[model samples]
Target: MNPLSRIRNFSIIAHIDHGKSTLADCLIQTCGAISEREMTQQVMDTMDIEKERGITIKAQSVRLSYQYQNETYILNLIDTPGHVDFSYEVSRSLASCEGALLVVDASQGVEAQTIANVYIALENNLEILPVLNKIDLPAANPERVIEEIEQTIGLECNQPLCVSAKTRLGIRELLERIIMQVPPPKGDPNAPTKALIYDSWFDNYLGALALVRVKEGAIKKGQRILVMGSNKNHEVLGLLYPHPIKQQQTEEIACGEIGIVILGLKSVTDIAVGDTMTDFKNPTKEAISGFEPAKPFVFAGIYPIETDKFEDLRDALDKLKLNDSSLTYEPETSIALGFGFRIGFLGLLHMEVIKERLEREFDLSLIATAPTVVYRITQTDGSTINIQNPSELPPEQKIAKIEEPYVKATIIVPSEFLGNIITLLNHRRGIQEKMEYLHETRVLLEYLIPTNEIVMDFYDKLKSCTKGYASFDYEPYEYREGDLVKLDVRVAGEIVDALSIIVPKSKSYDRGKELVVAMKEIIPRQLFEVAIQASIGNKIIARETVKSMGKNVTAKCYGGDITRKRKLLEKQKEGKKRMKSIGKVNLPQEAFLAVLKID
Candidate 1:
């Protein structure tokens, strides 16, 4: 086992697009973990979706050996996702670290996501080391950004190491600060094994793989360990030091070290994130805390293009869920959309990335319904239910009141666009709580807004209103009581549950009308006239009709009497009416996506 003084565990955190992956590459190169020719751009981002999106979707852990002053030190660096959608991932990564390198963009300074994550690190009671990145850019302003970080985050402003991850400038100095400033991990190696399972996944051949930070005692190969949360005991098949691309086998992983444990279990649910691993014969008195399973904030229905591929999609999801615990799904059936799964996500981008992976990695074409937040419905019998899909909402006669999720949103934008941003938030039923000027040009605004109001296109609208210069961050604030009503869309007199949504009572009529209009545009005209209606209860708020593809049935009776032609046309109308009664609406994929973009 390595001595406590020679081991350091920390994570690198930042806002989205803050060059976290780039900085990680520089660190890996300096440590000589991988050769310069072998290293790729964003080497930690092994997933194709992450590389395409230019974002980190998962937290990666790597052990590096650095020699300084003739002393060898072990550095365990846990790289975390920076997007707001994966903030929970950041929290889990921080739980396993002793400190964090708070990377700030030298050109952009502190952003909405950066401030949110810093608070999380502070809550973990870890030391914060601020590092200014992107100093090689022509527009880089290190001094101004450091000042902004101090003023915005209230951190002591002084000389922070300035480095260019792209050019590898000032990297050696930064590495020196890491050893000099970041504290080594502290734990008792003599104690019983109480390792924190911050991350876990499934391997096709290895069964369940868990990544843990050993808090106390040691775990050796072939040792029996118990998962505290699941109460499942498995003999450790192997222990591994997690390298970025390749893993190294080890005999025993002692306390204060990060390692992976192989458990020969098939099910992913058998292993839980945040659960502790302890000796089977002698267990720890207490399990690790502060790691909660990520609760999904966005919900949508995903259906395969072909019903025969349902099993394939399920298998793919099972495999994906092995790696992603934030993703939650269950069997769901829709009258309009048929059988599907109702999946939950942390945010919009998270949902997008998951869908993309399913299609790209799993080779399946899937359709996702409009996203909705979980709503609490109080029934007349005094029972409450938390519902994700709008179609799951109770009937009006049974519902006493409806409550929707809300978030405390923080927005950073130019002062010139403050008025426009305020108006947009007000329309979404936001109540302003605080507003402050960070600089002469930039302002920070905080507001309490309904989660449903912003899950769809709030960010896009905010950016559009500010000319793409605004940044946004939000977390689940509370479930507030509101007069929420379900708006159901009916095509050809059949309610399409997949397109249903819970909207504010005041704006239900307008929203219902807008959806009807949008559906009318996306749904192609059929052989029979289709009636598109948006309704709440028995009240029809809006209506549109897709005229049938007309055919000249009367043309067959050319040169016949006008009355004879009229009689033929009347017969055709009767046939069309009968077809409309039995005809089903086969909505295209575009129709499902259009509903999500409604204002």
Candidate 2:
């Protein structure tokens, strides 16, 4: 094995569909980490959903051996997702590296996420090597992209390494540059053992496996280690180097190396990401600093389609949470939806991925309610509480004010779509913060938008209006006071907790009307009329009726006495009124999803 100075730890960062994963494939192949026959596109993306969508969901790490300047050098590469929802994964990957390959699509130039990821890499103090990918395309404009990267992001990149991941062009030079430019890891091998847990997952055979980057000393097989955060001691049963094809087992993971530590533990919660692992006998003095836990920005209710599958859903979530620490959930029961859970996610995409995984991996059918943002409610008594579910909202008279989460959004688009983009932002109640032209053809816009505005279909609307040419990214800014009201949806005069939402007071009427109208189209008609009403506190804002399935009792009276027929009709009307008063409305899965299309 090479010394610490010969090992280079780096990650590839870029915007969505910018070829980050493809570039990783090129690197892995060039270093011969796996045989040519075993090579496949996007080898880092092991999940079926990831492969189907062509996106990296979880951050993946692999160790490769390369011969650079007559010496075998170890390269630890972490491939990170580019979507804004997966930014947490990118940040975690960046923490375990010393450098990053800023992969920018040659034709797309600088985008919103490109700048956002650069700031993260800069914060980690990683040496950034700008690389222009997909340069073989006919639309590839390397010179223009280079200029945009310098002007928009202000990176010192007059001469960036241009490469085409598809054609394997300029790949060798990339590897050489990584070895020369990226500095070696710095830590003492003789000091007490210290390793940072960047990622972890549960395995049926080995239990929970933690992928860590050793900072000091060494972690050996059968070594007792203490988790600094949990303050628990566990023995390291094995060590292995990460590879795309298969992990290679080893006896010891030395200092300044990246490897997986097997603790043979069944519970994944026992090991947390960002926790420090050290020798139990000679432990490190301090835990790693600047470690912030992942915070979920969107909340929604996830209920099993079959009421009996609630336990299966819970178990699935527990296993999923082991793979993704950002996901959170708690037992929540709804009068309308029965037993379920309120799950928290980083964004809408995260929510969708989780829902799909539960159905596909755990084989549990689920119905996910419309996504909503958290609101801080201040009562008349001067006490404050944060609530994510609309059903948990206090009464209007009891609440003094409500504050919603806000985000600083960055959008990069062509100059021609500026008007459409601005109009869309204005419609969503956004406040313009800044505007600058990256070049004559590209414009950058920044806005302060309420998180609730973009929780549902805002991204879809933006993409549609801009003709799919816009790149967007956002970060949590602050909580601001807003005129917000909880809009409740009622079926048969009974409130449905899963169908409620916290909307702005100004648009409450329109939103409520649209919601009830949408619900009316999905709710199945019963023997009696089903009243679909949207209300604010005690006041009804909008109402729609799913008319009863008509069955005439008068039809049974064939050409008999007119008085007898009238009496039969009157009795039928009385029965209908009584049925409406005692009947229950069954809401389909689409009724809960209707809230997303209310806008």
Off-target runs (Cα >4 Å) in candidate 2 are none
Q: Estimate TM-scores for all models.
A: 0.97, 0.98
Q: Per-residue lDDT tens digits of candidate 1, residues 165-199?
A: 98899988988788888898888888889999888
The sequence of per-residue lDDT tens digits that candidate 2 reaches over residues 387-506 is 988889987889999999999999999999999999999999999999999999999999999999999999999999999999999999999999988889988899898888888889
Q: Which residue pairs collide, candidate 1?
A: none
What are the lDDT scores of the predictions, listed in order?
A: 0.88, 0.91
Candidate 1 Cα outliers beyond 4 Å, as residue runs: 556-560
lDDT of 2: 0.91
lDDT of 1: 0.88
Candidate 2 clashes between residue pairs 3 or more apart in a chain or in different chains: none
